[model samples]
Target: MKIDARSVARILREPGALRVILLHGDDSGLIRERARLAATAIAPNLDDPFRVAVLDRDAADRLDEEIFALSLAGGRRVVWVRDGGDSLTAPLKASLARPSDTLVIVEAPGLASRARLRALAEAQADCAAIACYPEEGRALEASIRQMLAEEDIRIDPDALSWFAGLLGPNRAATRGEVEKLALYAGRGGQLSLDDVRMCIGDAAGVSLEDAAFAATAGDRAGADIAIERALAEGTSPIAVARSLLSHLHRLRRARIAMDGGQSRADAMRGLRPPVFFKRTDAFGQALSLWTAARLMEAAEQTQRLELECKQTGAPDLALCRRHIARLAATAMAGRRR
Candidate 1:
C-alpha cells in the first residue's frame, strides 16, 4: 500500500500487520528518520542482536534468513536495509511472499516511482511504500513550529517567515538548525527576527545564495569567497549550480516585469517569498544587467552545468567555480556597456 503524508506518522508508529515497509524519496534524511521510528517501534532496543539486524547492499543476500529468524527475547524483530535500490527487488519480493511477524524496513533514497522495489512493496497487501520529500511553504513552517514547541520555544511570525526562507532543502539539516535555535533561546524562550539572523544567517544555504547574488552582480571575488565557504561547509557542487540557476530564473522574472512597464521596486516586490532585504540592492543590480532572453540562455548553461557535475569523475568543484566566473564576467561586461 502507498502511504500519504498525513498517515505517515501513524503508520510508522503503529504499522499493524505490515511485513515489509519501504521508505524512499529525495529526502534521505526524512526517510532515515521515519525508518528509525518504525524500527524502534518494533524493537525498542535496536542494539539487541536477537531482535534487530542491520544490513547494507553488500549483505542483502541474507534478507531471507533475517526476516524468517525468530527473536530469542520473544518480541517482534526488525530487519533494517540501508541504501537499498532495485537490486533488492527479488529478495524483497521473495520475503514478502511468505508470512512473518518480523518487520523489514528498507531505506532507499532517490528511488524512482517506477522502481521494482517500490512497486513490489506497494502492491503487497502486507507491505507499504512511503515517499519522503522536502516540506515547503506552510508545511515547512508548521514543522519548524512543531520542533520548537517540543522544546517549549516560541517564534515571532516575522522571524518564522525569514527563518524559513534561509532553510536548506534537507529535512535533517533543517531540524539541526531549528534545534540549535531552540538551544540558544533556552526552554520557554521567544525568538525575534534578529535572534534567528544572528543564529543561522551563515548557514550553507545562505552562503550558496550569497555566491549566487555575487556572481550575478559582477563581484567575482565575493562569489569565489562565498562559494568556498559553502563548499567547505559540506554543500554539494550540484547544489551550488542549482542555486545559481534559481537566481537567474528569479532575475528573468523580474526583468520580464520591468520590460512590461513595472518599476524596479515593483518587480522585486512581486517576487514570491520576497527578496531578502539585505540582498535587495544586489538583486536589483543583477536585474538591471540581465535581459529576459539573456537570462534564459544563462539558465540553460547552468542546467548543463548540473548535468555535467553528475558525471563520474567530473571535477565538480572546478566546474562550479568556472561557471560562476563566467557569470561574473558577463555581468561586468553588461555593466561596462
Candidate 2:
C-alpha cells in the first residue's frame, strides 16, 4: 500500500507486516532517513549491518539469484537496491515474493509515472511505496516549526522572520542547516541568533545572515567584503552562492505562503531557526518593497552565479565576489523601495 510521508512515523512504530519498502525522493535526506528506518524496523534485532545484503543498481542481473540463495546465517537479511536499474525495471510484483526473514528496501529518485510499480505497490498486501518531494505549503512549514519545538529550540518572531527567510525547500537540507545552528549553540541549551551566526560562521567574518542582509539591503561593498572574507578563509565560492540561493528561495516561499492567508505565527512555526537575525532588518525591507517576481529573479541570479563558479576559472573568486556582492547589495536595496 502507499504510505504518505506525514504518517511515516506511525507506520514505523507499527510496521504491520510489510517486508518490502520503496522510499524514493528528490530530497536526499528524507529518502535515506526513511530507508534506514525501514531497514532497522524489519530487523530490529540486528546488531551487525554487514548481514544485510546491499545491491546497487549496477550490480549484475544475478541479483535475483544472489537474493534467492542468500541466507543471513543467523541474522536477518536486507537486500537494499539503490539507483535501481534492475530493481526498478524488474517485475515489481514478482520481486515481493521473498522470505519473511528478509526485507528489501528499494530507493529511487521518483517513479510516479511507472504504472507497474505504482500498481504493484498499491495492490500489495505486504509492501509499501512512499513518495518524498520537496516540502511545500502549510504542511512543510508546520513540520519545521514542530521539529524545533521538539528539539527544545525557542524561535521568537524576529528570529522566525530570519529563519523562515532562509529555510530550504526540503526537510533534509532544512534539518541539516538547523543542526548546524544547534551545534553552534554549543551545549548552551538555548538557541539564539548569535548561536546560529557563530555556528554557521565560515571564513567570511560575515555570517550567512550578513551576506543575506547585504543582498537584501543593497550594500554591495559590505557584501563584497563579506564574500572576500569568506573566500580568504577557505570557503568555496560555490558554497556561498548556494547558501545565498537557499536563503532567498525560503523567503520567496514564505511570501507565497503568507499571501495564501497563512498566519505569520503559522508560517514562523514551520520555519527552521538561525535565519541570520542580523539580516531581518534587510530581509524585511526586501519583503516589503519587492514583489515575489523580483525575489525569484534574484533567486535565479544566485543560481547562475553557482554555475559560473563551477564553469569559469578566470579569477573565479573575483567573478563570484562581483555578483555575490551585487546580489547582496540588491537584496538590501530591495528593502529600500
Candidate 3:
C-alpha cells in the first residue's frame, strides 16, 4: 500500500507484517532517514551479518538468496537495497511471492512514479511505498524548530523566519546547517537574529540575497560582485534569477501595502519571511524607488528571462547578469529622478 506523510511515522515504527517497504523520492536525505528507521525496526543491530544484508546495485543479483536466508541469531532479518530501481523489480517480486520474516527496505532516491518496483510495493498487501519530498513554508519552519528543539535550543521568532528563508530546499542540507547552528548555540542556549547571521550568513544563499538587494537598491558594483561570487560558489543562474524575482514580488506586495495607507515599516514587517535586519535599509530603499506598476513590469521581464534561461543551449549566465545589470540601471534612474 502507498503510505502518506501522516502515517509515515507510525508505519516506520510498527510496520506489522510488512515484507517490503520502498522509500523513494527526490529528497535523498529523507529517503535514507526513512529507510534507516524501517530497517532498524526489524533488525536492531544493522551491522549484524546474519540478521542484516546490505546490497548495492552491483550486488542485487543475490537479493533472492538474502531474502530467503534465515538468521543465525534467531531474530528477524533486514535486507537493505541501496540505489534501488526497476532493475531489482523482478527479484523483489519473486521474493515477495513467498512468505518470509525478513524485512526488505529499498532506498531509491529519484524513483519515477510509474516505476515497476514502486508499483509492486504499492499493490502488494504485505508491502508499502512511501514518497519523500522536501518540506516548504510552514512545514519547513516547523521542521527547523523541531530539530533545534531536540538539542534544547530556543530561537527568536524573527530569527526563525529569517533562518528558514536562508535555508536550502534540501532536507539533508538543511539538517546539516541546523546541526551546525545547534552546535554553535550549545545545549539550552538561545538563538537570536544576530546569532543566526553570525553562523550562516556566508552561505551562497546570502550572496544571492545580496545580489538581489543590491540590484534593487541601485548598487551596480555591489550587485555585480555579489552575483559573481554567488555563481562561483555553485549557485545556478536559474536560482539567482528566481531570487531576484522573489525580491521583486515581495517589493510589489509591500508597495501595495503602502498604497493601502500602511507605513513602510509596517509593510516590511508584514513580509512572510521577514527581511533580515541588516538588509532593512536596502529593502526600504527598493520599496521607495519601485512603484507597483514598475515592479510588475520588472517581474514580467524576469519571468521572460527565466523562460529564456530554460531554453536549450541558452547562455544562462550571461543572460542573468545582463538582466540584473538592467534592473540595477533602472533603479539608478529612479533614484536620480
Candidate 4:
C-alpha cells in the first residue's frame, strides 16, 4: 500500500514477512529512525533480525542476486535498500512487484513519480509507497506544542514561531532540539525563549539562514562575516553556493514570469517540492537587491570561486573567506544603484 509520512508509525506495525519500504527526505535523522523502526518491528532482537539485509546503491546488483537466490533462515527476512537512485536496476524493479515474504525497503533522496521502482511499486498489488517531508504550518506548530505539553512545559506562541524559524523544517532536528530542551527543564518549569536559546542546539537560526538573508539584503559586511562563520561552523561552501545559485535561478525565472504578468503565487506553481513561504519572500528580497547584471556577476564569481576551491591547492579557508566577502560586497553595491 502507498502511504504518507503520517502513516509511518502505523505502517511500521508490520512485524514479519518481507517488506520493501522506501523512505527518504532532506531530514536524515527521520529517514534513519523510520528505517530502524521498520526493522525493529520485524525483528525485535538486534542479534537476530533473522536474515536481515541492508543494501545501498552500490550494492544493488549484489543484493539483487542475493535476493534472487536466498531463502528465509528459518525466520522472517528483510531486505533494505537505502540511498537509492532515481531508479533501480531492472531485476530489482521486477522484484518489488508481487510482494514477497522477504520485506523490501527503499530510501531515495528525491525520486520522482516516474521513477522505475515507484512505477513498479504502484503497479504491484501488495506493495506500498510512503511519502515523507518536513512539517509545516499548524502541523509543525502543533508538534512543538505537543512536545512541550508532554514535558509539563508551557511556551509562548511567539517563541514557538521563533523556534520554528530557527530550526528549518527537518523533523529530526526538531526532535533533537526538543529532547535537549527537555533535559534542561527536567520535566518542570515554564519554558521560555531563553530556555530555547540555552538548550536547543539545533542547526537552525542565523547560520545558513542568516548568511542567505544577509546576502539577499545587500549587507556586504555582514554577509562576509556570516559566510566565514558559516563555513567555519561546518557549512559547505558548495552547498551554500548551490543554495545561492538555486534561489538566484528561481528569482530570474520568477522575475521573467512576473514580467510576462504572472503573480508571485502563480509563478511559484509547480516548483518541485514547492518553494517555502519564507523562501519566496527571501527570493523577492534578493530580486530587489540584485539586478540581472549583479546576478550575472554573482553567479560568475561563485562559479569561479567554486572552481578554485576544487582545483587549486591554496588554503580553502582563506580563499572562501575572500571570495564570499567580495561576492557580498558586490551584491551590497547593487542595491545602491
Total clashing pairs for each candidate: 0, 18, 0, 16
Candidate 2 vs candidate 4: the lDDT winner is: 4
Per-residue error for 157 in candidate 3, Å, reads 2.5
**Model 3: CA > 4 A from native:** 231-246, 257-274, 299-326
lDDT of 3: 0.87
lDDT of 1 by residue, 213-287 (tens): 998999999999998998888777777776777689889999999999999999999986578788999999998
Please provide, for model 3 over 23-70, each residue's C-alpha lDDT reduced to its tens digit, 9 standing for 90 to 100: 988778878878888888887888899999999977778999999998
Q: At residue 155, what lDDT does model 3 achieve?
A: 94
Per-residue lDDT for 40-141 in model 2, tens only? 775664455555666777773745654555564565566777765334546445555655546667777655546565556656868777877666435655
lDDT top scorer: 1
The 0-to-1 C-alpha lDDT of every candidate, in the order given, reads: 0.88, 0.62, 0.87, 0.64
lDDT of 4 by residue, 1-337 (tens): 5666566677778733434666655556566667777877765654554467777788767666555545445655667788876546476666655345666667775676677777665555556666666665577778878887888877766566556555544566678777777777777667665566556543534465556656766676777777676666555555455545555565567656766777757766644434555556655666566666566667777677667655546566676667656656665676677
Off by over 4 Å in 2: 44-51, 60-62, 65-76, 97-101, 136-161, 170-172, 186-188, 203-212, 219-337
lDDT of 2: 0.62
Candidate 4 residue 131 Cα shift, in angstroms, is: 2.1
lDDT of 4 at 17: 42
